[model samples]
Target chain A: MARSTLYQQVASELRRAIYSGDLGPGDQLPTEADLMTSYGVSRNTVRLALGELVNEGLISRTPRRGSIVRDRRPLLMYPQRELTPQPASVPREAFGFAVSQEGREPSQVIEVSIVEPPEDIAIRLELPDGGLAVVRRRLRFVDGQPYNTNDSFFPHALVRDSEIVRPGDILRGANRVLEELGHPQVRVVDDISARMPTPAESSRLELEPGTPVVEYVRVGYDSDDVPVRVAVSVLPADKHLIRYELERR
Target chain B: MARSTLYQQVASELRRAIYSGDLGPGDQLPTEADLMTSYGVSRNTVRLALGELVNEGLISRTPRRGSIVRDRRPLLMYPQRELTPQPASVPREAFGFAVSQEGREPSQVIEVSIVEPPEDIAIRLELPDGGLAVVRRRLRFVDGQPYNTNDSFFPHALVRDSEIVRPGDILRGANRVLEELGHPQVRVVDDISARMPTPAESSRLELEPGTPVVEYVRVGYDSDDVPVRVAVSVLPADKHLIRYELERR
Candidate 1:
C-alpha cells in the first residue's frame, strides 16, 4: 500500500504541475530516468503514475516527444436555450448575447455574409445545392482575447429579405437576425464533441498544443418544428466551462 | 480564384489522407522538398497549403517533426434518457434483477464493483467532504469492443448496509441500485461539450487526429431533489449521435 501511495503522490504532483501551467501543452515531460531521479521512484512506479494520468485525460506520450502535457481546458457549451428567450419581455441588461455580462466581459466581433453554402450546410437549411444562405461567422473574444469561432447558416430567403441581414453588422448574432425574420426559436437541439484544436483554431482561440476543443452543433427550430438555423461553435476546453440545470417534475 | 482553389484542393486531399489512415496520427508528413516534388507546387504554395491543414485541425507541426497527422477518432455519446426503460416493468432475466426484451441486445457481463472515488469526484457527488461513497466503474462493450465507460458514486453508508454493495456486482447499475435503496432518480441534468481528442483519448477510443469527442457531465437527482450521482463520460463524436426532444406547453 505504501509503495502504491507513492504513485498516487506522483500523479497528484504532475496533475498540479500541468494545471498550474508549469508544464504547457506539447512541452516534453522529463524522461523516466529524470522522473525516477527526481521522485526517487522505480520506473514501474513512474509508469503506473503516468498510466493513471493517461486514463484521466492528462499527459500524453508520443513516440519521440516522451510525454507532453495535455491541455486541461474546461469545455464550454453555450446552450441554445440561453440564446432563445421566452416570449415574455426580457431586460436589455440581461442580454448576454454579444458579451459576457460580468467578470472579464468577453465581447465578440463577427462577419456575417449571405453566401452560397456548401452542400452539407445547404442541406441543413433545407436549401437547394448551391443555393444562397446567410452564413454568419463570429470570432468571439473573452476580454479581447479570441476565445472561440462560431459559424451559423440560415436559408437566405428568410434573412436576406430582412433589414438586419446587411453585411455591415451581419454578426449581431443568428438569434437576433432570426427575431427580425419573425421565426423566433421555440426549440433547440445541441450536439456536442471535442477534438484537438486546428492550428488556426489554436491561434484564434489561443489554444495550447495537445489541448482539445469542444464543438457544439446546435439546430434551432421554430414553433412549427421547422428547423430554422444551424450554428457550429468550437471552443477551447481549457478556458471555458459548461453548466446545466435539471429540475424534478 | 483558380490559384486559391488549387490550395484548397490540396488541403482537402491531405485531410482525406489523414482520415483514411493513409497518414496515421503522429506520422510525419512529406518534407517541403518532397511535397513540392510530389505535388508539383512551389515551396510557398506547399507551405500555404500546409498552413490551411493546420488550421483545419488535421495536422500538427513540431519544431523537429515538421508536420504530423492528427488522430481523427470521433466521440460517442449515449443519451441518459435512453437508459431509462420506457417500459417501467423490469424483466426477470437470469439474475434476480429484471431485463427487457428490447430492440438491442444486452451483453451478459455481470460487471459491478464498489470502491472509493477520487477527491474531485467526491466533491461533485457532494459526499459530505471526506465521507465515503460506493464508486463503481465499468466499460460497456458491444459485440466485444468497448462502447462507453460508466462510473457512478453513491453515499457509502446507504449502500454499505445493503446486499447490493458487494465488491462484485453493485446492484446492476447506479439507477437500479438507487431504486433498490428506495431513492429513485427523479431528475437528470446533462452538460455537454465537444472537441478534438488528445493523444491519450485517441488511443483509448481508437481515434485518430481530428477525430472529435463529446464530454458529458451528468448529475442525477433523487425524488427529494438532492444530488445523488455524478457521472463523467467521454463519447466519440463520429460514432455516436445524440437526439433530444423538447416540448412546449
Candidate 2:
C-alpha cells in the first residue's frame, strides 16, 4: 500500500468531481492557474493531473475552451439483434433501429465496391482462392456526428445481382436481402477486441488522442453452415457500449 | 485521398510484413540504421515509423532489444460458457477450462471480504440501502503472469455462512456454491466496454504504455429473477479476445 504521488492525488480529486456529477458533460474545469492555487502545486503538476483525465477520456482540452468534461452517454449496441429475425414492420438495420429508439437520427454514407477482400475477411466469408467480394463500406453517424464504421463483405458470386452490389443504402436491410436470396443467416459468431485507433481511424471518427476503438467482427453462417457475410465494425470506445443477455439452458 | 507522409510509407511496409506473416511473433524488427538505409529516410523518420507500430500494439520497443513483434495470440473467452451447465466430472470454472484446453496453466490468488458494496454493484444486486456484500477479489494469472482480475460480489445475507466468505480458491467455483444454497442463477446480463486502464490497474496487469482494457460486468439472476451475483472482470485488451455465438430462433 504505497502512497499516491502529488499529481495522482490532484487527478483523483477531479475524477471524483466528474464521477459524482459535481462537474458534468460540457462543464468547464477550473483553469490551470486556478487548479494550481487550489491544489497548492506548481503549474507542471496541475498539467500532469489534467493529462491523466485526458488519457482516461473523461475530459478534452482545447486552446480556447481549456478543459471540458466529455459526453459519456455511450450508445448501447445489441449484437444479437442483427442475427435474430426482425418483425416485418421494422425494416431498419440494427444500428438505425437502436439509434432511433434513443430518439437520435441515424445516417450513413455507403460506398459499394467489388474487390479482393482482406485475407481475414476472405477466410471468414470462406471465399475461394482469388475469389472476389462485394463490400459495402459505411461511415455511420448519429446526430450528424461520425460515430462508427461498418463494412460488410459478401461473396461476389452470390451478391453480383443483388442490391448489395449497388451503391446506395438498403432501407429494407441487407439481412432481409440475404433471406430473399435464399442465403439467410441462421447463426453468427462475434469477436470483439479493443486497441488504439489508427491515424486514419482517428481522422474518420474524429476521436480524441487517447481514445481507443473496439474492433467487432461478425461472421454470419447460412442454414447449410456456409459462411455468407462478414461484417466488421470499428466503434469508438467512448461512444459505444456492447451488451449481451444469456439464459441458462 | 491525400498522399501519405514519408514516415507513414515506411510504417505501412513494415505493417504489411507483420500482417502477412513475413515477420512473426517475437521476431526482431530491422535495426534503426538498417531501416533508415532501406527506406532512405532520416533517423527521425525511422523512429516515427516504429512509433506508429508501437501505438498500434503491433510491436514493443526496449532499450536493449530495440523493437520486436508482439505476441498477438489472444486468449479467446467465451462468456456464454459460464452460464451453461457443465458435466458432473467438470468442476472447473469457464476460464480455467478454457485456459487448460489451450494447454496453458491457469491460476489465481483470491481475497474474500465483507464490506459495503459500491453503488453500482448495490443497484445491480438489488440490495437495500446499507446492505453489505461479500466480495471475492481475484487476480487471475496465466502461465504465472498476471492476466486479469475478476471481482465477484454477493449479498452478505445470502452467503454469510457459505464458503464464498472464506479467503481461498473454490475448486467447484462460487457459482456452484450458490446453487447449493438454492440460489442458482438462470439468467445473466453482460455489459462490455473499454478504456485506458487506471494507474493501479496498469500496474496490476503489467500493461504496456499504450494498452487499453476491457471492462466486462455480468449480473446474474436466480430462477426467481432475484439478482444474486455481479462479477466484474478487467481484461487487458492485448491479452484477451471475447467471442459469442448466436443462433436465430
Candidate 3:
C-alpha cells in the first residue's frame, strides 16, 4: 500500500513539471534507471509511475526513444464564424479555411448516400416516420494526418435534387447549395459532449491510447423553423479547441 | 489472433444492442456462462468482451451484479443564458436555476482566496506583472450528487473590497457585484476543450475510469475592453452536455 502511494506521488511530481513547462513538448523524461535511483524506489515502482503518465495521455513511451512529452497545441475553432458571411473571394469550407489560416493543409474524403437516418437524428430533423435522408460522411485530415470526422444528414425530400446528393467536395460548401435549393438555414442549435472513442474510432483516427473525443452535434432550421440539417463531428480532444465570442445586445 | 477477433466481434454486437436501445440503461446483460455458450466462445473471451464494454463507459461490472448498462442521460447546459438579463424575482445563479427547472436540488461549497493568479488566467485578465486576484472556487452538487466546479477570478484592484472576497456563497452571483463596482462586462469570450482528468481532479470529482473532462474558460471584458473577470469550469463530460443556440442575422 505504501509503495502504491509512492508511485502516485512520483507521478504527480512529474505531471506538475510537465504542466509547469519545465518539461515541454518533445522533451524526454529521465531514463528509467535514473528515475528509479532519484526516487529511491524499485524498478517496478518507477515503471508503474511512468505507466500512470501514459494513461493520462501526457507522454508516450517507446523502447528505443523512451518517454517524450506530446505536443498539445490544439487547433482553435471558431464555430460562430460559420454563420458569418465571408468575402466572395474565399471559396472554401470552414474547416479548410481555418486550417489554411494556421498555415496547415486540410483535406477530406467524402461519401454520400441516401438512407433512413438514425432515430435520434430523425427526431432532431423532425422527419416523418420512415422518412429517408441523404447522408454525407467525411473523414477529415490535417497535413495528411486523420484529425476528425463529419457526418451530415439532410431530409432527402428537401435536398435530393441538390449537389449534396452528388459526389466529391462541395468547393463552395453545402450551405450555399442549401440556399440555392431555397431551404437556407436561419438558425442552428449545437450540442457538445465528450466520451472515450470506440475501438473502431480509435483505429480510424489513429488516436493515442487514453485520448478522448468530443462529439458535437448541430441541428439547422430554415426560416420557417423547419429542421433542415444535422451535422455531427467527432473531434480528438487533444487536437481541437472550440471558442465563442459573445457581446451583450 | 482468431480469439482476439472473436472477442471484439462479441463486444461490437453488445455495443450495437446498447446503442440501438435493445439493451436499455439499467438493463442486465446475459451471464458470463450464458454468453460463452451463446457465442460458442471460451470464458476468457466472454470476459474480454465485457471488459471492452466497461472501458467504453457503457456498462459496469461487479461480483454480485455481474454487468449492467450505465445511465448516460446528461444534464443539458445552456451557457448563453448566463449573459441574458434575469428578472428581479429570480435571485438564483444560472446553475441553480437550471437544476431547479429540471426538478433537482442544487447546492455548492465555495472558498474565497486572494493570491497571485496562474499565468494563463493572469494573461486573460490582462493583469500587470506580479498582480494579484481574488478567486471564488465552488464545488457544486445536484440532487446530493457531486456535479462540477466553477472557479471565478476577479482583478484584486477591481473587487478587493466587494462581497466577492468574502467566504461563502454569493446569493446573487459575483457578476452582480462586478456590475455594482462599475465594471459591467460588455463582452466575453469562451474557450472549451476536453482532456483526461488529472489524478487530483479525478478523485475530487469522483469520476469513473475512462471519463474525460471539459475545461471551459470565459473571460469577460468591460466597455473599455479591459478583461475584469475570468471564470473556469471543469465539467465531467459524462454527466453534462453544453448547448448553444445561434441565429443568423
Worst 10 residues of 3 chain B by lDDT: B1-10
Q: DockQ of candidate 3?
A: 0.27
TM-score of chain A of each: 0.61, 0.73, 0.72
Model 2 TM-score, all chains together = 0.75
By DockQ, the best candidate is: 2
- Tens digits of lDDT, candidate 1, B1-249: 012356567776776676555788789999988988888887766665776566445677776879888663222233534445434454432112311221123343334455567655664555553577766555544434455545567777777776445655533444665777887767776766665667767776566566666666677777775567777766676545554434333
Query: lDDT per residue, candidate 1, A84-188, as tens digits?
Result: 454444333112432432223546676777788754455445554357877768777654567778787877777767744565443344565566677877676
**What do the candidate models score in CA lDDT, each in turn?**
0.61, 0.85, 0.83
- True lDDT of residue A85, candidate 1: 54
Give the docking tier of candidate 1: incorrect
- Best candidate according to TM-score: 2
Candidate 3 residue B42 C-alpha distance from true site, Å? 49
Colliding pairs, model 3: none
DockQ of every candidate: 0.16, 0.29, 0.27
Worst 10 residues of 2 chain B by lDDT: B1-10
TM-score of chain B of each: 0.55, 0.73, 0.72
**Models ranked on DockQ:** 2, 3, 1
Error of 1 at A248 (Å): 5.5
Model 3: share of real contacts kept: 0.70
